[model samples]
Target: MEYLIPFNRPFLTGKENEFVNEVFRTRNLSGNGPFTKKSQAFFENRFGFGKCLLTTSCTDALEMAAILIDIKPGDEVIVPSYTFVSSANPFILRGAKIVFIDSKNNHPSLDENQIESLITKKTKAIVVVHYAGTACNMELVMSIAAKYKLYVIEDAAQAIANNYSFSDKSKKFLGSFGHLATFSFHETKNISSGEGGLLVINDKTLVERAEIIWEKGTNRNAFFKGIVDKYNWVDVGSSFLPSELIAALLYSQLQSLDEIQKKRIAIWNQYKNGLKEWALLNDVEISYIPEYSGNNAHIFYLIFNTSEKRDNLILKLKNKGILSVFHYLSLHKSPYYKDKHDGRELVNSDRYSDCLLRLPLFVDLTEKEVTHIINIIVN
Candidate 1:
């Protein structure tokens, strides 16, 4: 059924076509062209990140990370089972065993406290997802990684512009905390191209090697730099780069990021304020951002008292020409992995799986449309 209000509608900043036209004028349609380099450099300089490699999708970035860390059979990687499949798949594909952790009782972020207990001699890395663009407790994660000599991969797919705060009253962007991190520019994300992703390398040691892996296991990037007379296949990798056109489109969105963020945050506030009273009276909980996290307003979701209540609300909203939706099913219990799972009960992961609902959120959603959604859900 077509609804008056849908769950999501991708927003455009009006400069996308002009940039694409420039790419055409230059006649470079392949990856790592002028637009691609400019976009990569923009992210590096703006975020203070080390070498950045643009990819076709966040999944590709994560896959590159798995290869970089040399994940292999019998190796274990710790990750939250509450996240999307991409968070775990890359490592799993590399023959690494996934050690799924539960979410914290308060938020969907990984229960960092449970991480150490999951680590073993076979543990190679910890993949942490900053769910809903909220920051995870990086201090604890980093300290633990240091203690065990493990790699930390921040699956910052939803955390493009969010910051992680420290007790010293200083802040670091979410993707910068881990040795390696990934970000998404999918249409549903805060800033987007049609489909794009970035791999951020912070270890410095990994920078040179990452380029080789990014260039389809070749030294082409080095050869182009005149660092080598000719390039050859040097390691394992793939064609992860997006076309110059995609980069051009993404660069246009990045230009207006601050303005887009302003509108999104305003819409997010409208939802929170509009529903706060009703949520309390009805015994429901809206999305919560901890003080240590910066809000990017990436998504607005609610946790109902029970799965039944959540399902009922969705049906009621649907009847009123509105579309509300649920999020990921707990991966540990998924049919594909249940037999392989160690069978530890991930209570909070299951709780979120059954009871959480995501509401309409996008840059183009008007106050009137938001009000209509709020009023329908309130009643």
Candidate 2:
């Protein structure tokens, strides 16, 4: 089952071991240690995010957002169907009804135009997933949220280092627009801490409570800072913080973010150029970066004309000792949610479910390996 080229190989910044050794020397192994603080501060300073907290996983961060937003039973939350389950699961756990939206005609991002019609009196929030690191139209999204007085959460799990440019060419980081945002550092992401995530609080009013929730629903952080005489449980929360070891590993990659992004975008361009002609002849659509979004090269995929063709390409790559794979299926059609879904059909989401194929892409993947993958596809 092994392949010469796999879908992903986590890249290390060479300083990871050095950082881990420093953690050991300091002997502060729990969460919120020096390493954790440094990693959190890096995001806040670099991206201008209001406040940051590292979590055990992106799911935990989303859960924290749900709590902060106070999602209640029967409240409806609009979300795109073309995404991983984590995008919607957090709100569902809070007893909210998920009103699934369709992907845009030419892009996998949720259609911003269709959002308003779907909002109802029960609607409480909108969850936007920046699929393959492309930002959804934040200007329109924020305007709609403002009009409806709804919460907006950016699920930036695949979008670290991505920037969204407005029409005027002013740029803002992907996770900075939403009232709340979350990120992932899974091995497959641009950054890796083995498994880690972050919650960004753009609403300063929520900063104090977010810190409390991140610290197991206690006022312990305030107590340590001498703001409170004694810490006690004051809110509903969980043990969301990841240990210092995860932060140490994550901070090492933060220092190398610029280099990692430059290399990835270069590789992405190579695939686009090499496959341009063959893809046209074969009617295979290579991925496109939206005008408003800068490429972070989080994924490079092809959309075949049919499901059979997509499946065949996977087998062909496998036969040649390479590995390629598909991404999220329509969550509205998922087994657990299928019957629960209203009868509306999401055409683009379903098409992507069947035809989109993600090729092998990672920092460690060499040029020779990439050319081999392209040649196989074009052949």
Per-model TM against the reference: 0.99, 0.99
Worst 10 residues of 1 by lDDT: 42-51
Q: Report the lDDT tens digits of candidate 2 across residue range 1-379.
A: 9889989999999999999999899998999999899999999999989899999999999999999999999999999999999999999999999999999978888999999999999999999999999889999999999999999999999999999998889999999999999999999999999999999999999999999999889998899899999999999889999999999999999999999998898889999999989999999889888899988999999998899999999999999999999999999999999999998999999999999999998998899889989888887
lDDT of 1: 0.93
Model 1 clashes, total count: 0
lDDT of 1 at 314: 95
Misplaced by over 4 Å in model 2 are none
Q: Give one clash count per candidate, in the order shown.
A: 0, 0
Tens digits of per-residue lDDT for model 1 on 260-366? 99999999999999999999999998999998999999989999879999999999999998889999999999989999999899999999999999999998899
